[model samples]
Target: MKAVGVVVEYNPFHNGHLYHLRESVKKSNADIVIAVMSGYFLQRGEPALVSKWERTKMALQGGVDLVVELPYAFATQKAETFANGAVSILDALHCSYLCFGSETGDIAPFLHTNEFLQKESEQYEEYIKHFMQTGVNYPTALSLAYQKISNRKDTLDLSQPNNILGFHYVKAISKLNSNMIPLTIKRYKAGYHDKDFASTSIASATSIRNSLFDQNADISSYVPNDTYTILEKYKEQYGVFHQWENYFSFLKYSLLTMKEEELKSIYEVEEGLENRVLKLIIDSHCFQDFMEQLKTKRYTWTRLQRLCMHILTRTSKQEMNLINQHETSPYIRLLGMSERGQEYLRSIKKNLKLPIISKVSGFHHPLFEIDLRAAATYFMIFPEPLRSRLLKTEYTTPPIRMSY
Candidate 1:
């Protein structure tokens, strides 16, 4: 009953994801696969194409034995924090291995990179600080710093998105001293940010999402049958797929009503960003326009979007600070599980490091409360009857049980 864990968002489980899942199972040689998935929102600071529940069904149908929700505090943060939370949960679950999709595809490079960085941590920090002070974004600063110290061809290229995340996954495992062995699978044809369909069958999630929104394009060929079915079902029931533009009006309202001091209290709102948002919010007509005006060399679009998402959900800096005071995730929240997954959990339940949450009624952690607020805010984009119904599901919907 060995288990392999993967940190995923499954924005809408597609062919590339299916390939990764299958490949992970083969590579890890484990009996079951467990996924730590994002809820409501994604790491890029965008709302998920569908809710977590629907995505859970997709995961189960696509072959994941278990699915756990990545708390909002970690899911929407940068790569380092996101990996720390996700990897810790897998370790808590007592997974034997962690499998991730990366550009490098070789586990050796990630190990080498982590070890090199650890030995050169002081010099790396100095280089990062020097780069950041020159007006480059954080990701850019990291890439520059890595290049400055490590010229070895065997190390991962930090500039690639999946490679960056995979490196952090390795770093987190070492930091926690977890027993899980790390594995990697090369990503399929399409790139992470690919906007158009690059392959006939192996399209990126970004391309699939863009097609879905741009023309209501049929994505059946790009995803598994169950994933396609779930996508259609979600859109049919919710009337529209979730996206940032859908919540633009509400975001505008939030910015309009909140005072400068209040906006400044939100997480990631720093360095006079509150004032800049206050001044620009009124003149902007849409989310894209507002972002364009607010975008600066120092702030990446992803970072800015995350800031806006925090403002929209009223996620205060104090709340995040309180949650961060703890070393790892406060709890492991189950979203779905198969028969094998249930059996595995039962075996490990006694030895589990974190409490496993099947229902939210008795839970009272600050991180859990942020997840609740995020759920509430996410459903606000819907019309009245639908909004109330969807919001109620946040508490009422139990972890999905599946047989296969």
Candidate 2:
């Protein structure tokens, strides 16, 4: 059985995702689809609308044959790190192809862009440093650097979010010397950051999430029935969908109680950012207000949000640095698998590079410990028995098996 891999967050698994999944299968002509999903926190440094397990059910029901957790260390980082971690996992699983949604939809541009960047790697770094020194943000610096060096009209636009990730995915595959063929499907109607329901059926996850949180809008038409049902069940059982604003009070508490030195130790807390946060945190009322006060030209909202997430979870620079020393994750955390997925894994089990972790009972690794802490922090918003119950599930639950 051949398998194609996809990197996803599946915050709520909507129509766009369904389209991508089905299209990936058709384009790759693979027997099964495997997804490496983010756990708790997402790439933009916000809590998932639902938990990982719930999202896994959505993935399975949506047609993914297998689901694995992308450790927090990788999930919350920038596109490069996130892509490296996810692609490495797929390569470790011996996948035949990696398919992603992109703005260009053409795989050749991603390949060409990556090759161009590789040839001018040193010059690209110099350009980025020069741009950053002029007060532009990292993303802006990257775009400027790429524009400065990229002479080919066929190269992808690095400014677009999905395009940036696609470029990085292709880059990672080359860096790892993996044989996985890269493929892409053009994103549907809504853009990555679109916040309104522009399309009748296809809507961005951001738009869906905003609608849900802003007015309890019905998103049944945008997502699959299974996704909608799971989301409703999660909200009913947990009292509210998870979001950054939900944890603002706790974040404020953390900011208030921690010493300056302690805050400085957190990952991404650099260049006197700890001082800015410590000074601004006292006067801010909510997460939004705090971010507004702290936002600077050099620090993007996504970057600051990731820093805040690291601080909220008490992740330190030392820990992140130690983990970065490794090229890939030590273990492949199996979140869920279908019958076909199970059979495929069995076929390749002996030749696998990483251990597949089905249970967390005695799993011991520095990186895994960070994942555990991230889960605990994610569950901290819930009250009493529910909080304890969810945390306990993290350790006790086995891989979700789908019979169909």
Candidate 3:
């Protein structure tokens, strides 16, 4: 049986995501679809709008066969590392194809570009160093390198978020030498960063989230009925959505109390950034203000946010680097699954390479500890019932299994 894999951060699953899931199944002609998704924290180094449980339920409700947690170490990382973790999990699960939504809606150029980048590694490196010395950021430097080395500017348009991620996904597949074929579906309606809701069935997750944050606004037009219902239910009971500003005080407290040596040890803290962060934390008011104060040519907003997250969670660079060298993902933790997904898992149970974790006690790893700490930090912003309920150890939380 053929299976298609998708890497996602549902944030809150909406109509556009539903469209991608359905279209991916048709495009891959797969018997099952597996989604590797982020947990509470996201790639941009911010808390998710809702809990992972709610997001996983949204995925299963939207027709995903299986949903697995992308570990904290990799989920909240740069594009390449994020792709590597997701691709490694899917490849180990024996997925036949990797399906993703891209603004360009074509996979051929990404493939060709990946090959070119690999073939011109030395030249790319030289160009990257040269651009870095000129004070350009890492991503921009890499893009400049690609243009100089490949002379195929059209193949590497880093301005488009989906295109940038697609390139990294293909690169990760090649690095693993995995047999997964890459496929892309044209993104519909809104762009990744589009904040305004479009008058269409498919709206960007960003728009849907922004609407949800406003108490009086309606978002039914942007999301599936089940997703809307889930948000409504949570909004009534435990307060559903959150932005980084909600947790800024705790992060500020963390920074103020953190030692200079400890701050320096956190992942992504470089070039005496610990000292800069210490000085800036005193003057910054909100999360946005803090990010603005820290942003420079060397560090993008996203990179700075990631650094903030590391400080908040107290994740040391030593621990993260050591974990990455030792394991791609030590175990696959099931988050949610439909009946069909469970059936697929049953069929592959004996032949699987990585351990399928439905319970927390199934595996013990240092990375999992980091995930727990991250979850604790995320849940601190939530209300009492939810905060207490979700703060349980990984072993205690059962995977959400549903017939839908």
Give me candidate 2's TM-score against the actual structure: 0.99
Tens digits of lDDT, candidate 3, 123-195: 8899999999999888888888777766565565656789989999999889988999999998988889889
Would you list the clashing residue pairs of candidate 2? none
lDDT, candidate 1, 1-404, per-residue tens: 89999999998899998999999999989999999999998899999999999999999999999999999999999999999999999999999999999988899999999999999999999999999999999999999999999889998899999999999999999999999999999998999999999979999998899889976588889999998888888777777888888999999999999988899899999999999999999999989999999999999999999999999999999999965776578899999999999999999999999999898898888889999999999999888888999899999999999998
Candidate 1: 10-residue stretch with minimal lDDT? 321-330
Off by over 4 Å in 3: 383-386
**Angstrom error at residue 107, model 3:** 1.2
Tens digit of lDDT per residue, candidate 2, span 1-404?
Answer: 88999999998899999999999999999999999999999889899999999999999999999999999999999999999999999999999999999999999999988888889999999999999999999999999999998888988899999999999999999999999999999998989999999889999999999988975488999999999999888878788888899889989999999999999899999999988999999989889999999999999999999999999999999988865787577789999999999999999999998999998987798889999999999999888988999999999888999887
Report lDDT per candidate: 0.93, 0.93, 0.87
CA error at residue 188 for candidate 3, angstroms: 1.1
User: How does each model score on TM-score?
Assistant: 0.99, 0.99, 0.96
In angstroms, give how far residue 175 of model 1 lies from its true place.
Answer: 0.2
